[model samples]
Target: MIKLRPQPLRGRPTVSVVVPCYNYGRFLPDCVSGVLGQEEVEVDVVIVDDASPDGSSVVARRLAAADQRVRLIAHETNRGHIATYNEGLAVAEGEFVVLLSADDLLSPGSLARSVALLQAHPEVGMVYGFSPTFADRPPTPRTTARSWSIWPGLEWIEQMCRRMSNPVSTPEVVMRGSLMREFVGYDKRLPHAADLLLWLRAATRGPIGRINGADQAFYRKHGANMHVEMFAGVYTDIAERRRTFDILFDEDSACFPDGHQLREVALRSLAREALVTMCQAEKLGQVGDEPHDKLVALAAEMCPPERDPRLWRAYERTQTRSRSGRGPVVPRTVGRAMADLGGRIRWRRWRRTGLMSAVGSL
Candidate 1:
C-alpha cells in the first residue's frame, strides 16, 4: 500500500481532477486540455502515469512542467488502477474530486456546473451529469445548465438496485473530497464495479445531486476500456456483482437499519442481474453448460426459497431462448424488418408508460 501525505494548496482550487493513464499517451493532450479549459472554476489536475509502457510519462511531465496547476505522478513500477487512483486521491486537495480516465474527456463547462451544484447543496455527497458514450467519433458538445436535482440517497440507491446495472459513467461523476477522505479508498476486491460500490457508499452518506443535461463528459468506448474487457468475459461479471452487493450490504447496514430488508433487496438484485446476464449470454451464443449451471446454482442460493419458482421460471426461459435462438429463422431482410417493428413497439410502450422509472419504483 502506498502512503499518501496531504500537500499544501497554493490558492485553494475548488475541484481536483485526477486523470489516471495507462498506455493512453495519445489521449493525454485532449484529457488535460479538457480539464484546463473548464469555465468559471479554479481546478487543479493531477495526471498519474502508472508506469505505462507508452510515452505517457513524457506527456505527463510536459504538462506538469508547462502549467503550475497540473502535476504529474509517475510510478516506477506499474501499479494497478486502484493504487494509482488512491495515490492521486491522497494528493488531491480540492473540495470536489474526479477520477477521470485518460482516454475520456470532460465536456465544456462541466466543472463549473458541477462545482456550483455542490456548493449550493451541502447535503449532497456526490454529483453527476449525463455522459454520452462514443466509439469511433465523439459526439457534439452541448451547453449544460446551472440547475440540478437533489434526490434522497436511499431513493437513488433503491433506483440503482432495481436497474441492476451502473447508470452513472465514471468520468462524469464528482465526489465530495471530505467524504472521500473519511472512508477507505475504492475496494480492491471489486475490480469491475469499484466505482459502483464507491458511488453507493457516497450515497449512503448524503443525498445525490444530478445535473440534468447532456454533454458532461465523453466516455470513449474503445476495445481496451475496462468495462469492455469485463463484459467480454475477462472477468466473471456475476461474481463481481455479488461481491459488490456484499460490500454494499456490509458497509451500509447502518444506513439501511433493517437487515432483512437489505438482504432481500440484495438477493432480488442478484437474481435480476443473473437473469439479465443469461439473456445477454444467450444473445451472444456464449452460454455454455458449465457456466449456465453455475449461474443457476448461484441464483438458487441467493434467492429466497419461496421466490425460487419465479426465478427458476425466468432462468428456464433464458435457457429455452438460448437453445431455440431468438425469433424465427427468417431471411435477412425480413429479420431486419421484424427487428425494426419490435423496436418501434418497445419505444412506444416506453414513452407511454415510462418503463424505466416504473421498474425503478418496483
Candidate 2:
C-alpha cells in the first residue's frame, strides 16, 4: 500500500483568535490586524486585558466596539496571565480558539491551515501548527514534526510525563473551544507553564493533530520577555508544573503520575542554571551578599558536582589577569571550572562558609 498524505480542508472554517494582552501597546495593532485579515475563514478576536496601566483596556474596548468580530473583556484589577486567558475562554464562541499573545503577529492564513486539520480529524482534541520566529530580529527557529499518526487508544498523561518536549507551542496551538472546558481550562497556579501543561494534557488525552506549514506566528523578543526573568526563579516554574501534573494525573488515578517532564525538565533546569550563573556572576560586581547568596543557593540547586567547574580557580585566573594589568584570562582548567559551579556553594552562613565542597577536590 502506498502512503498518501492527508488532503487540506475545502471550506471556510470558524476560527477564534484570543489575544491575551497586558501593557503591550506597541505591537498589538499587528496582532489585531493579523486576525482580522483572515477573510477566508470566520474569526473572532477575544481580547482580555489584565488591568494594564498603558491603556490596553481602552484599545481592546475600542477594537470590540469597532468590529463586531472582536469581543473585549476588562479586568478591574490586575489579574495574572492565567486568569486573563480564562476570562477569554469562558466567553469565546468560535469552533476553535487560538491564543495570540499581544506581542505576536500571525502569518497570513495560518489559522485556515490549522482549521483544516481539525475539520478533517473530528476525533482529535487539538490541532497545532508550526510558529517560527517572524519579527525582523533573529527569531528562535524551532524545527519539529508537522504530522503525527495518533491511534485511537493510549494514555496521554504517562507519555507527556515521560517525554520532555510537549511540542505544542503556545502560539501555534489551536484548540476546540469546547475542549477548553472539558479539562479545568488552565491551572491558575502554573502560570509559568500553564499553556504547556494544558496543551500537554490535551494532546495526550485525545488524538493529537499537527499542520506543518511555512507560515507561522511571530513571537516578539524584547527586554520584557518572561523567559529572561525565569532565571531569577521563574524557570523553577518546573516546580509548579510538577505540582500541577501530579495532582491532575492523580485525580484520574487510572492515569499514571509523572514525577516530572523527565527530559525537558532537566534541560530547562540547565538553561535556568546557565541564566542564574550569568546573572549571579554579573551581580557579584555590582551588589552585596543577599542577592549574591540567593544566587549562590540557586547555583547549588542548579549545578551538581558532576557538572560544575571550579570557581576558586576561575578567581585565580582573574588574579592572573590582574597581574598583567588587563582583564581576566580563563585558563583551560579554570575555564572548565568557571563553566559549571552551581552544586558547590554553601546553603547558609551559620551552617557553613562560602563554597566548601570543591576546594580540596579541585
Per-model RMSD to reference:
7.1, 10.4
| Ten residues in sequence with the least summed lDDT for candidate 2 | 349-358
lDDT of 2 by residue, 1-362 (tens): 01114556567778888888899856667689878987568888888888899988887777788889887887889978888888888777788888888988777667776676677778777765555544444354333224433433133434444333344457867788888867656887676777766766675567666554243566665664422442354335445554555555555445434433443344334334333344433423322222544444444554443354554344335445545766334444554455334323321210121111211121
Q: Pick the candidate with the highest TM-score.
A: 1
Count clashing residue pairs per candidate: 0, 6
Winning candidate number (lDDT): 1
- Candidate 2 wrong stretches, greater than 4 Å: 1-6, 134-159, 224-235, 256-362
Off by over 4 Å in 1: 1-13, 224-231, 283-290, 317-362
Residue pairs whose backbone atoms clash in candidate 2:
299-342, 303-343, 308-340, 309-337, 309-340, 310-337
